[model samples]
Target: MLKLFFRHKWGPALLILLLAALVFFYNLGDISLWDPDEPRGAVIAHEMLQRGDWIHLSYNGHPVTDNPALVKPPLYYWSIALFSALQGHVDEFSARLPSALAGITTAILVFFLGARIFGTKTGFLGGLIFISNHMLFEQARSAEIDMTLTFLITAALFLFYHCYHEHYRPGWLYPAYAALGLAVLAKGPVGVIVPLMIAFLYLLARRDLKAIGKIKLPAGLLIILAVASPWFILEGRAFGAEFFFRQNFERFFHAFDHIQPWYYYFVKLPIHFLPWTLLLPAAVAYWFRRRKEKNPGRTFLLIWFIATFVFFSLSQSKRSLYIVPLYPALSLLVAEALERISSEQNLASLLPWIRGGAAFFALLLVTAGGTAAWLAATRFHDLARPVALLVAAALAGAALLYRMIRKGEGRGIVTAFLVCAFGLELLMAGVVYPSIDVKSRSS
Candidate 1:
């Protein structure tokens, strides 16, 4: 079964999506809605279904306010409501279904986009990395709008990239524009703003400024207006301009909450990105050494990462999840690096760092398991069985990965890392979250 993935082009894609589905949909409804965001979204969708009012946003039976619950556009609320309606009721599962679907779609998108730019193997690895991304794992299982927004942004970027490369007819631009428009509905102007900025920068970098003319800016704007304006206009008429200013403009310039130092992502991103994060520096260096080559794929990915990172870093309101859309670009780059190393490309110097990274993560996982074991022994006695099982799994994975790294087996190393990631996510879904739920209820 595993051999088929290496032997066939389509096998990896199928396997990746299946793995993503298992990780994402497993025990999705077991936990209660998390505080603030989850319950807020579920309850609002419930109310919207009851009131049959989709346009105007509200929470807890009150008119929408500038609070986090009512700050964004209604697309996510509409999604939850739609899913709930189909499911006959809104629970954790129904509330989070949209995000799970989006997460899965995003995983496949990463795979296809990577395959488009790199190759099938790199694409498969990239998709595997994305599915195991800690942020994606958490958000996909929750009722947050970030995953859905990330999906829209990723789709918009991927479609626009295809349009730019003429991989599709000019007609492709329309759906790309529609995606941008829907993204606006998902969040706000930033949804449209970020992608357009990245696209413009990419064109400018390529010195193909004339390509901008082909984008049909005027018609595209109209499409965006047609798709995103109805709810904003209706809501504006009902609530005036206050919500718009506060939610969009004010939040960016002078965020009332979640304000962080400019360098917040500098620290946060590396942590959330995990074992793959260590590979990023090597991937970047490899790309830099090859900068003289005119690789549009590499250029566009670098721009996507830089533009998204700088854009969010500059914003006053920042959360780690705000950069979820950037993970695909990162994953593709890391996958390219891994692929090159496996093929013995000019990235020989990077091999040591890659091995070191695997070893480091193996040690980290072992350490984490030990910590959990300690806590189980000295503190949470009730969680001893699951904790011990997790610890054993962690140790076994760590030992296997370390062996792969020592043997200098590039493909084995990647496979082992992914297998460990899958195991960790399984443990997380099967044990950790449920344990947290139990503790939350007990407390």
Candidate 2:
């Protein structure tokens, strides 16, 4: 039994899932729903349930049908309402449970997508990277629409890749379109916009505008309209078509709120990517080296990243969660690159890249742990132990990973980095989270 558990094809995926569950679900409801978004989302659903009118939602007894501003779409609240109804309450656990479940399912889907397209190793790494990511950890545990929206977007992309790119199965596009339709319901227009951007640009990059002709457009549209139109019809009459405009167009150009500079996402992306962000250089180097190849999979991932980045950059209303849709693409790109580092045999080809990754990861962990130390020593003096211990772990990880890299042990270096990521999480759980709780309560 133990051997099967360890040696199964999905062994790594299952293990990473366990870790992800621990990270995302262990104390999901222990912390109160964060004000504004979390609580607001919860109330919208709970109120809808009480009124037995799922189509229209209200908050604090006022209509929240405006979209992208005072109100959000009903899909997320509907989901929360269903989960809360099942669990017999609208408390924290039931409210946040759906997002956490979606997060886990998304991670699993990442594994499946990677394994199908790249290899099992890439799948395992991709799943691990997706779950261990800085933003996924936070978003998964929170009762917010962004994570659920991310799941739908990612599912659509994966289905598209499977049906259009790999298998030539037209049936897959139906589900893919359905996923996009659901994504549109989950958020607003951005859901459909993201898929269109990725699918169109990827085909355009291949210089085949007619490639879209192969998709089941009529059937796909039917699926989309069937799944998505009902809510819009109801909500449009309840609110107005202007709500849709505000959710989509206004957010793009006007920046009524969530205003940030054009470069805001550029600065914030790497931080959300966290530990794996250290591997971006290696990923880029691989992309350059393989640029001559005609690999459609790699081309698709690159297009996914580039198109999403450019699209979000154009939007005047920017928030860190806006990039959640892009994380799966980032995961696949980094996983494919990391798999190369693990498997490549050419020292000269691999040395410079590995050296950069190793050095960056070591320095990153040390700097993060050191920053925690400084904060705990001075500003956060009461939370010194976890931060200081994290510093020690970071130093230890640096020494070990650097040594492994020098020895040409690519896998060992990755393992050491994973260890350090866990160390950081531990410190956050021990020191940072408690500090936040106390501060929240006092305030």
Candidate 3:
């Protein structure tokens, strides 16, 4: 079994493991929904189900009239509502199931796009990085529209990348635009605006204005209207003209959520890309350095990443998950960097700092695991020694893998990344979830 698994292509097997892990962790906890946002979102869907008034969102048996027009579109909430109606009551699993599934599906789409645009190795690395992201996992297990919006926007991005690379088929641009329209429904105008801005900039950068013209704008616009118009029309009829103008247009301009400086995203970027953050500068430099090589795929992805960063940076409201769509691009860039470094005979001399940095992180993980076990034993005696032993074993395994890679293992650095991420995910799903469950029950 082990030989067969190892013989199979690593990408598909890794993806299957990721999906299975996500599904398992997703089902581990009890039905206690997280507070302030997740449960609130679920309740909105539940109220919608009860009242049958999709346009006006209600909370706690009263009309939530504070800033009508549905606040956010109803894609995620509607999905939860449908699921809850079937199940008789919305639980944590039911509310969060859609986002979890969407997250996994998004990873699959990234794999396909990455493979087509770059190579199979790049795709595998990209998918592993995305699924291993702590923020992505957290959002997947919570009831939020952000993950759904990210999924739609990413789908649109995948289609758009293909459309640009392979001559724009009339059929391709339509679905691409249609996905963007659904993104709008999932979040707001940022969906349509972000992709359009990125594509325009990408074409302009490539000096491919003629290719842009082949998009069949009229048909694409109609597709967008077809997918996105009904909700806007219904909401406008239910509310007033202010629904469109204030909620859609003015909100962007006036900083409706909370205004932050232009440098807000700059501050948050490191935390958003934790563990992988150290390698981003090298990745970005590698991307621009290779641009003159006329690599359309890398160029397009870089443009997508930069455009999204700039767009959200300038937005009045900002959040970490807003940048989730950009991670795939970053992952690709990182993978490219790793591949380039690996190919060079003097790789050890060139990237001594990176190698040391990775070793440090691996050591840190081991230290943190030991510290956590000590705390559990001393402060929280309720935790079983068996669980602590499992966690320690996993951490030790990760550290050993890191050491082996440092010593020039048979597998490459990409494999090291895969093993580390896979170990961390297993630790979370296996050891951490059980710990959380025990604490919840005792409380």
Clash numbers, per candidate = 0, 0, 0
lDDT of 3 by residue, 1-443 (tens): 63454344554646555664555355534546756578777888888888888766677876544545345677788888887889888777778877877777777777777778766666666776677656666676668787787788788778877776676766777778888888877877777888788788888988888866787777777888888888777765543345556665675567676567888878877665655665555555555556568777777878888889987786676667778777767766676666665555544443554555466657667776777777777787766564576557658755675875567632354466556665666666566766776678668
- Best first by TM-score, ranked: 1, 2, 3
Model 2 / residue 187 / CA error / Å: 0.9
List candidate 1 segments past 4 Å from native.
1-9, 66-69, 238-240
C-alpha root-mean-square deviation, each candidate:
1.8, 2.7, 3.6
Cand. 2 Cα-lDDT: 0.79
Clashing pairs in 2: none
For residues 348-416, what per-residue lDDT tens digits would candidate 1 score against the true structure? 777777787788889898999999999999999999888988999999999998899879867788888
Predicted model with the maximum TM-score: 1
| Highest lDDT scorer | 1
What local distance difference test score does each model get? 0.85, 0.79, 0.69
TM-score of 3: 0.86
